[model samples]
Target: MVSITISAAKRTSLAKDLPATLNFPDKTVDTLTVSDVKSAFAAKYPQFYPSRQKISLKGDNKLLADEATLASVGLTDGAELAVKDLGAQISWTTVFVIEYIGPLVVHPLMYHFPSVFYRTTVEHSLLQKYVYAMVMLHFLKREYESLFVHRYSHGTMPFAYVFRNSFHYHVLGGVALAYAAYSPTYANTSSYIVGTIRDDPKFLMGGALVWLWAEVSNLKTHVTLRDLRPAGTKTRAIPYGYGFNKITCPNYFFEIVGWLVVCVMTGSYAAWFFLITGTYMMALWAMKKHRNYKKEFGKAYPKRNIMIPFIW
Candidate 1:
C-alpha cells in the first residue's frame, strides 16, 4: 500500500473545512485510479462529491482522468496532488431537459395563444403552420436525443449555466421566433401574400427538403459521437466516419444549417438573430473541441475544419 497526499486548493469556499493533507490508507500507486481517490475524498468530505471535484498533480495544470491508473500518471508513494472544488453541480440530463423543454413549450404557446403575446391575432397562414410543425419536430428530436442518444462524459455541469442556456432557447429561440413568424405583421407582409414568396410551392418544398436533410444529418453526427464512447463509460476516442472526416464538429455544422433553413423559410429577423447567435456559440465550442482533439491525439488526429466542411 502507498500513501498519496491530496491538498485542497485555496480558491474554494470549502477549503477551510478540508484537511491540509489527506492520506489514502487503502490504495497502492499501481492499483488505484483517479476515480478511486475521488471516491475516498467524497467519503471524507461529503460536500466534495466526485462529480464536483477536479483533481490533478500538485504542480500540473492538466486534470487527471478518472479512468487513468495513478501509476500511469506518474503518481508514486509520496506523490502530492491538488484538488479543486467545481462548485455546485446539476445533472446534465436535467439541464438539457430544462433548456429544451422551454423552447418546446414556449413556442407552441405563442403560436396557439397569439393574444397573450400580441394585441391583435391573425388567422394562421399555411406558412406559419409549416413553421410550427418544423419547430415542434426539431425540439422533439432534441429532447429525444438528449434523453436517449447522447452519452455525456461528465454527468453534471455548473448549476449556474442552466439559467443562461434556458434564456437563449426559451426567450430568444422560442418566444421571439414564434412571434416573428405567427404575428399579424407576418401575415400582412407583402412577401407572404397569397401569390408571393410564401405561396410559392418551390420555396416551401426546397426549405422543407433542406431542413429535413439537416435534421437527419445532425442526428447521424450525434450518433457517431455517442457510439465513440461506449455506454456506461467516460472514455473518449478520436471519432471517424461520415461527417467526422470533413469537420471536427459536423453536428454543429448540420445544426446551423437546420436553423438557417428555418430563418430563410420564416423570413424573420428574430430567426436570423437566433441562427447567428447560435452559430457563433457553436463555433466557439467547435474550435475548443478541435483544439482539444489536436492536443489529445497529436499527429494521430485527422485534419478537419472546426465546423464548416472545407471552407473554414
Candidate 2:
C-alpha cells in the first residue's frame, strides 16, 4: 500500500479525522485509477462523492481525469494531491447559457411586458427591436459559439461560479438593460435612407453593419485559433487575421465593437453603462492576454496593441 497526503484548499467535514491521509494498494500489485481513488475516498469520507471532488496535483491547474491511473498522473508513494470540494461540476457551455439565456429571453420580454409585472408600462417603437435583436444576437451567438466554436483546456467550471455568473449576467445585466430600455420614457427615432445619414438609419444601419462585421471577424478568428491545435495535438500558435495585425486579441476588439454599436443604437444610458463596463472588463482581459502572448512567444511575437487598434 502507498500512503499519500491530501491537503484540501477548503476544509470540509472530511477533516473529522484532523488530517487527510489515505493508503491505496500499490499500482504494481493493483492498478488504481482516479475512479478507484475517488471510490475509496467516498467510502472513507461520506461527506464527499467522486463527482463532487476535484483532485489535482498540488499547485497545478489541471484536474485528474476519472480513468487516469494513480501513477499515470505522476502520483507515487509520497505524492500529494490537493483536493478541493467543487460541490458540482458543469460544462462551460451550459454555464454560459444559464448565465446569458436569461438575459436574452428577459430583455425582449421587458419591451412588451405588462405593467403589472414591471413597475411601469414597458413599450417599444419600430427601431427598439433593432437594439433588442442586437442584444439577442450577442447572447445567442455566445451560446452557439461556446458549443461549436470555442474550446477550453478545462471544459468544466467550479459550481459556485456557475450560479454567480448567472446572477451577474441575467439578474443585474439582463433585467437592468431591459428595465432601462423598455421603460415608458424609452422612445425611438424615425429614419430615412442614405440621405438622412444622421438619424435612425445611421444608428440601425451603422450599428447592424458593425455588429455583423464584428461577429463574422470574431468567428473567423476563433476558427483560426481552434485550427492551430488541430485534431489530436495540444500545440498552440499565434492567430492571424482581421485586426490581428494591430491587436493580440482581435476577438475582444470585435466583441467590444459589437456591443458599442448596440449601445449607440439603443441610445439608452443603461446600454451605455453596460457597454462601458463590459469594455473595461474586456480591456483588462485583453491586456492580460497581451502580456501572456508576449511571455509565451517572446521576440517571435509582434509588439502591438492589446485589444484596441493603435490606442490600447
Candidate 3:
C-alpha cells in the first residue's frame, strides 16, 4: 500500500476536521489519477465536492490536473498533497441562464411599456422599433447559445459572479439602453428629426447589415469553438478557421462590433456606454484566453491578436 498525506492548504469550516492521510492500494497506485485522489478525498470530506476542490502537490504552486495520473505527475508513496477550498459553486449553465433571463425579459418590458419605465407613454419611431428588434434578436440568440450551443471548461463558477453578470446585462444592456433609445429624448434628438443623418435610409440599412453580419460571424466563431470539444467533456482543442485565423477570441470581437453597431443605429449615449464597458470586459477576457492558449500550445498555437484584428 502507498500512503499519501492530504493537508488543507486553505481550510473552511466544513473541512477543518478532514483526515490527514489517504491510502492507495499498491496495485492501483501507478494507475490512479488525480481525479481518483479527489474522489477519495471527497469520500472523507463530502463538503468538498470534486468541482470545488483545487489540489496541488504539497509546497508546489502548480495545480494537479484531474485527468493526469498520479504516477505521471511524479507522485509516489509518502507524497503529500494540499487541497484548497474553492467555496460554493454554481453551474455555468445556471449562471448564464440567470444572467440572460434578466435582459431577455427586461428589455421588452422597457420597449413595450414605456409608461412603466419612463413614467409616460411616448410614440416610438420606426428607427426605435428597428433598434428594439435587433436588441431582442441579440439576447434571444445569446439565450439559445447559453442553453444549447456553448460548452464551458469549468462546470461551475463562484456563486457571487452570477449577480454581477446579471446586473451588467439586465441593468445596463436592457433597462438603461432601452430607455435611452426608446425615450422621448431620443426621438427629439437631431438625428431622429426628419431628413436628418439618422433618418437617412442608407445609414440605417448599412448599420443593419453590419449588425447582422457581426451576429452571424459571432455565431460561427462559437460553433467552431464548440466543435473543438465534444459534449460532456472539458477537452480542449485549438480552434481554427473563420475568425480564429486572425484573432484569439473572435466571438468577443464580433459581439463588441454588433453592440457598437447598435449604438450607432440608436444614437443613444446609454447604448454607447454599455458597448464601451462590455468591450473593455470582453477585451480582458480575450487577453486572458489568449494567454492561456499560448501557454497550453506554446509554439504550435497560431500567432494572432487577442481580440482586435491587425491591432489589439
Q: lDDT for each of the candidates?
A: 0.85, 0.72, 0.84
Question: By descending lDDT, how would the candidates be arranged?
Answer: 1, 3, 2
Model 3 lDDT vs. the true structure? 0.84
lDDT of 2 by residue, 254-282 (tens): 88788777666666678788778777788
Top candidate by lDDT: 1
Q: Each model's number of backbone clashes?
A: 0, 0, 0
Residue lDDT tens for model 3, 1-312:
777788878757767864478887753657878888888888888888888888898887678888888788887887888888887899998888888787778778877888887798777766777788898899889888998899998899888878888888989987788778878765644345566766767888889899999999999999999999999898878999999999999999999999988877776789999989999899889888999999999999988989999998
lDDT of 1 by residue, 177-214 (tens): 87788887656444455777886768888898999999
Which parts of model 2 have CA positions greater than 4 angstroms off? 1-3, 7-10, 14-76, 79-82, 114-123, 188-199, 230-235
Q: Evaluate residue 133 in candidate 1 and report its C-alpha lDDT on the 0 to 100 scale.
A: 86
Root-mean-square deviation (CA) per prediction: 2.4, 5.0, 2.3
Against the true structure, candidate 1 reaches a TM-score of: 0.90
TM-score of each: 0.90, 0.75, 0.91
The residue pairs found clashing in candidate 1 are: none
What residue runs in model 1 are displaced by over 4 Å at the alpha carbon? 11-16, 20-25, 59-62, 69-75, 188-192
